[model samples]
Target: MNKQQTETMQNTLAQNKNLLQNEQTLVNKQVGLNINKNSENLDDLLEFVKKETQTFKDISARGSSYVSIVKSENGTRFVINKATNEKLGYPTEIYIGYKDEHLMIFNAEGMAVNKLTVRQTKNKITIYNTKLVDEIINHFGIDFSEITSKSFAEGYFENKGREILYVKLL
Candidate 1:
């Protein structure tokens, strides 16, 4: 191979290594978050996140790093960092379980009043809850609808080393 091509390959490898390292740092932070497993605290946590997002508007921007709290259908709660332009992947259900349905949207102010519509393809699961999504948009008072479930799933898969939380059964 030409010297130029070899240099280009080396550069690409270095970039990938950097991305992997950044992702690993994010994963470690996520794993270290202290989230309460009890359902009762869900509201409090949701409220705190809502308030934090509002208070830290600049930090909450899309391009900025922020914390994302997610609770799956099986009631597992975890906090992850929203890094870069990439959306995080689907919750651990896709890998840890074989069924799809029932993803609960938690709102501290008791505002997630909607039904979930689950759509599953070979490697992805998209859950759409219009009311819930709307509530989130309204709660955060921002237009983040562009970040769809599909995008999150894509992001999740692309960032291979990131941790995916699977909530323990109560």
Candidate 2:
């Protein structure tokens, strides 16, 4: 081939090589971006799965013998589980008192102070007192709007020769 024709051929080959390199660089960048996006999505999915697993474990680990405070638009109710009610001999009347951040449930047979009537069922004993519930909420500094109910474990003990079923607030 003539010198001019040969030089033209070399230039064309160089231009083609440069174009190929540019195309490869673009492809590499696109692949890198896809990998980063997929990694972020995977992290989000794993976090969601972890939260769901923890919720399931919490629900499954709860015990039946517990005291619960339930709130509603009408009022609030304190509930004692069947095991606790049986332990207390299923009293129709109880005296509810609070001191030192502890909720005290006393048998009403020998007590005459702040007697509260309670409803007893096969599964639970329920006490309904709106004022008492409000006082507890205020004392505990609890967010009433965020919580619908809370449960606690109880201890039966004797204080000053009196048997009491008490729940310590958190």
Candidate 3:
């Protein structure tokens, strides 16, 4: 080969080598970042598991009057603790009414036209309804997207000889 052609080939080979080295460096950095991110995710998962285990133990130990609001992809659930459920007469069917940032649960036997079925477990009574929860959240201007669950203290009152249990949302 001519000297000029030999020089040109050398330059091309150097440029190719540089490009390959740069690409390898970038790949190495990406791999390191991915490893660090995965470690962080594992740590977060472990922490969450520990927290939930402790919460379950605490709930099991207490028979308290409270309302827990839980949000999931399927819908929102209002869970009444066992003590509160007993106070509400262990309702098989319930009427949920919302007004002024308060949700009231009343026994539905011969009392209300609109009613929701109650899902009773040993520790709690759960009522699931999507629209009512959505309306209450929207009306109260509550941003519940980042929140998974919340608990509120319950209050009891009687009106027109009807018993009602209520939780005020803030």
Report the C-alpha displacement of residue 154, candidate 1, in angstroms: 14
Model 1: per-residue lDDT, tens digit, 9-75? 9999999999997887786567454445464345555455546544322323442322232333443
Model 2, stretches more than 4 Å misplaced? 1-65, 154-156, 159-162
Off by over 4 Å in 3: 1-65, 73-75
User: Model 2, range 1-170, lDDT digits (tens) per residue?
Assistant: 99999999999999999999788778756644223433524444445444643322233125553577878776698788887777666877777777776777766756667787787877588777778777777886656587788777633344444457776654
Q: Can you write out model 3's per-residue Cα lDDT over 28-77, one digit (the tens) per residue?
A: 56644223433524444435444643333243224453687677775687
Q: What is the lDDT of candidate 1?
A: 0.36
Task: Please rank every candidate by TM-score, starting with the best.
Answer: 2, 3, 1
Best by TM-score: 2
- Consecutive 10-residue window with the lowest summed lDDT within model 2: 52-61
When summed lDDT is taken over every stretch of 10 residues in candidate 3, the lowest stretch is 53-62
Candidate 2 matches the true fold with a TM-score of: 0.55
TM-score for all models, in order of appearance: 0.22, 0.55, 0.54
